[model samples]
Target chain A: MENESFYDFGGPEPEPARPSIGRLSTVVANPTATGVEAVIEECAALSRSLDGILALIVATSDGMLIHSTWSEVEGMRAAAISAAALGLGQRIASDFGQGEFHDSVVSTGDRVIGIYAVGDRHVLGVVAAAEDVTLGLLHLSARRTAQAIGRVLSDS
Target chain B: MSEIDVINFKLVVTGPFAAGKTTFIGAVSEIPVVTTETGTSEGREVKDHTTVSMDFGKVSVADESQLIELYLFGTPGQSRFDFMWDILSKGMLGYVLLVDATRPETWTDAAAIKAKFDELGDVPLVVGVNRGTESDVDKVVAALRLDEAVPVLACEATDKESVKQVLITLLINVVEQLEATVKGSI
Candidate 1:
C-alpha cells in the first residue's frame, strides 16, 4: 500500500504516443517545422495588411531570426537591430521608472521602424514608408500584429 | 590655466555562454552597469539569465598629467547573438576574451568566437581564463590556438583586482600596437 502505483491497477501504462516515422523524417529533413512556417505566414500577413510596409520581422530577444519578409541577409541584420532596439528601450524604461516598456518607434527621413515586444522572449519589427503611413496608424497596426505574432509563437 | 590631456578608449569583453563577461564588467565599472539580460531558455540549468544584446559600463583612470576614460562593452555569448559582436567591435581599441576554467566543453565555442573576432579586425586581444589557475591558462592558450604574443592570464571575473589586471594587460597590448603604427608612419 505504501508503494502503490497507477501501474498496479492498469498493468504497464500504454506506450506513450510515438511520433510517426513520416513525421520524424519531416522533422529531421526540415528542422524548421510547421511552427516556423506559421510564424512566417503571420509575418507575411502583417506585411500584406499594412500599406507601404517595407518589412516585417520576428526575432528572438537574443537576436535570432524567427521570420522576416526581407532577404535572408537583410532579415538577419534587421533581426539583430530589432533585438538591440528592444533591449535599449526596455533599459530606458526601467532606469526612468517608466514601468514595462511596450514599444518604441524610430522615425527616419524616409521610413519608420517600430519595435514591439511580442510576449517576453520575442520582438516584432515593422518598417514602413514615412510618407505613406501615419504614426498613429502604424502603431495601431503594429501592436495588433505583434499580439498575433505572440500568439503564434506561444502556440508553437 | 593648465589643461589635462584626455583620451577615450573602447574595450570589448566577449566569451562563450556563462563565461562571466557581465560579471567582469560589473566588478570594474564605476557606474551602474547597463545590461540587456533576458531569461535563459536553453541554458537555464547553468544560468537563469543571459545577455541578449550588450552590457555597457565606464571607468576612468586619472592622473595629474592625463585622464583616460575606458568604455567597456560586453557582448552576448551565444552564437545567435553574434550580430551584436560585429556591432560592438566597431571603434574598439582592443578586446578581452574570457573562458570559464570549469567548463571545458565551452572551450570549442570560445575558440570559434575568437576566430570570428580575429576576422572582424586587427585589434589587440587578451585571453582571461576566469576561475582558473596558471595551468588552466596554458590549456586555454593551446585550446584557443593563441599566439605567443597574446597575453593569457588566470583571473576571477568577480574580483576587481583580477579583472583590472586583465584590462591592464590588454591596454598594454593596445598601447604597443599604437606605438608600432606610429613608428610605421614615421
Candidate 2:
C-alpha cells in the first residue's frame, strides 16, 4: 500500500557537519596576554644548557620574535633572518622533491647560525661560536631544543 | 572596507634591477633593513649581487599627533623573481617605481613593471628617477612616456630627506585615491 511515487530522489544525505574543535585564537584580542611566557621559559633553559652560545631566539614563521636571549635589535634581526632562511630552504627542498626539510646552517669566520624548524609555524634560531662546537653536536642540540619548543607552541 | 582605525600602512618600492630601490628604503627606514641579496649570475658586470626575495624597512609618520607606522617593501626587479612581487605588494597602500635615470635604456622596463602593477588593482604610485641630474628628469620623463598626471621627480636614494619626500608624495596620492573611492561608493 506504500506509494512508490512519493519516494525521494535525493542522494545520500550529507554527512553531519564535523564537530568544531577549539584552538588558540590566531588573532589575539588583548596584546598584553599572549601566552608567550611558556615559550620564553623554554628558550631560557635551552640557552643555559649550551656553552658558547651567542644567541637563542624563538620566532613565528612570519618573522615576529617570540623570545630571545639577546638584545632587542639582535633578536629582531635573528628572527627576520631565520624566517627568510627557512623560506628559501623550504623552496629549495620542495623544488628538488626533497621531502621534509630539517635545518639551515650558515657558518662565518667566528660564529655559526643555525635555523631549525620547530612546528608548523615556528622556528628556533641559535648562534654559537664555531671554534668550540662541532657541527654534529650543534645540530643535535638544536634539533632537540626545537622539538621541545614545538610542543610548547602547539599546546593550547 | 572601512579600515580607518588601522594606522599601519605598507608601501612597495619596485623597479628594474639595480634601480636603487633597496638603498631608498634603507635611507628612510628606522629599523635595520632586511635584505635577501644573492650573487648575480647574469648581470655581474653591472652589479655583483641582486635581491632574490625582497627588502623590508619600517618608518613612522606623525601627522597631527596621530602616529602612523609605514612599512616599506622593495621588490626584486628581475622578471624571473616576479613571483615575489605579488606576495610583497598584497594589501599595499601604494608603491614607488625607482628608475635609474642615467640608464635611459631601462626606462621601458620600469614602465612595463608599472603596467603590471596597474593590472593588479587601482593603487596610487609615483615614479622616482634616481641618480639622475635635474636635467635628466625631463629626458627620463619623455623616454618613459609618463602620463601628465603621474608625479615624476629626481631623487637621491642615498639621501634620507629626498627619499622621505618621495614617500610623502606617494602617501598624498594614496589619500586622494582612497577619498575618491569612498565618494564614488556613496
Candidate 3:
C-alpha cells in the first residue's frame, strides 16, 4: 500500500517538488509499527486530537535519523537527509540570526506537513494526512512536537 | 540563449518587522513565490517575526546576448537578530537597505548597517527609503548618509519601477568598482 494512493486525493491536486506527498497518501493507511515509543505516543495523541496521519521524525542536521514514527518508509537514512535540508534552513536562519528557524510545510498531492528544528542538533518533522488541517492547528501541533523532540533529543 | 552562461546571483531583501519586505518582493517577483508565512497573534501571543530564516525569490530576465538572473533573499530586519549577518553577507555584491522615510532616527541605524556592509570589504550599497509620500524625500536622503555620489532613491515598496531603479544603481556601482579594480591591477 506504500505507493498506491492515486485515487484517494480530493480530485486532482497539483504536484510538488518532492514525491513524498503522493507517496505518503499511499502509505498513510499502511500498517505502521510505531517506530519511536514516546514520539509515537505523542503522535497517536496528536493524530487522534487532530485530523491527519502525523509523520514525525527527529534526526541529526546531517540527515542521520535519531528517532521517528511508523510513517517513514525509507527510514533512518532518509530522516538524515530531511535533517540536512532542515540544517540548510537553520544555516540560512543562522546567517542572519533571524532567529532559529522553526518549521516549513509542503502541501501537494493531498499532503500537508511541517518540518521544524527541534533540538540542538535535531529536527522534528511531521505530516498531516487530511489536507484541511488549518495552519493554526499545524503550528500548534508543530510547536508541541518541536518541544517534545527538543526534550527527547537533549537526552540523546 | 546559451544555457551555459546562466549566473544566478543572490540578493537579500531586508527591512524592519512591518516594513513591507514581504510585499516588496511579492510585487516584483516574476514567479509564484513560496512563503513561510504564519498567522497573526494579537495581544496574547508574541510576535515571532516574519523571517526566522531568509525568504527567497528568483527572477529571470533575458536580453539579446545574455540572460541575467537575480535571486532575492529577504532577511529579517531586527537588529537584535543580527547573529546571522556575518555569514549572510559573504560573497554578496551589494545590499539594498530599506529605510522607513518617516523615521529619520533610523538613519543612524542605517549608518551602522552601512558599516556592517563595509565589513564585507568594498561591496556596493543602495538605500531604498520607502517614500509613499512626495514630501518625505529630503529627510530620507539626508538620513541614509547619501552624499552627492551614492544612489539614494525614494521608493514605494510595492512598485516594480522603484525597485528597478535601486537595482540599476547597484549594478552601475558594481561596474564602476570592477573598472577601478582592473585599473588598479593594471
Best by TM-score: 2
lDDT by residue for model 2 over B77-117, one digit each (tens)? 98887766665565567889899987788888888898888
Across A1-156, the per-residue lDDT of candidate 2 in tens digits comes to 121222232311222211111111122111122336666666666656666576677766545456666555445555655665666666566667677667889898977879898875677887777886777888888898889877766763
Candidate 1 lDDT tens digits, B72-117: 8799999988877866665567899999998999999999999999
Model 1 spans with C-alpha error above 4 angstroms: A1-156
Better of 1 and 2 by DockQ: 2
Docking class of 3: incorrect
Task: Give me the chain B TM-score of candidate 2.
Answer: 0.93
For each candidate, the alpha-carbon lDDT, in order, equals 0.75, 0.71, 0.56
- Writing each residue's lDDT as its tens digit, candidate 3 over A13-70 gives 2211121111111101211223234544555566566766545555544333344553
lDDT of 3 by residue, B3-108 (tens): 4354334455665555566666666766444344554443124344465445445565556655555545565555755644543443455667777776665567
Candidate 3, position B59, lDDT:
61
Fnat of each candidate:
0.06, 0.04, 0.00
List, for all models, the DockQ compared with the true complex: 0.04, 0.05, 0.03
Q: Which residue ranges in model 2 land beyond 4 Å of their true spot?
A: A1-32, A60-62, A98-100, A118-122, A131-156, B1-10, B31-56, B63-66, B82-94, B111-126, B131-154, B171-186
Which should have the higher lDDT, number 1 or number 3?
A: 1
Give the higher-lDDT candidate: 1 or 2: 1
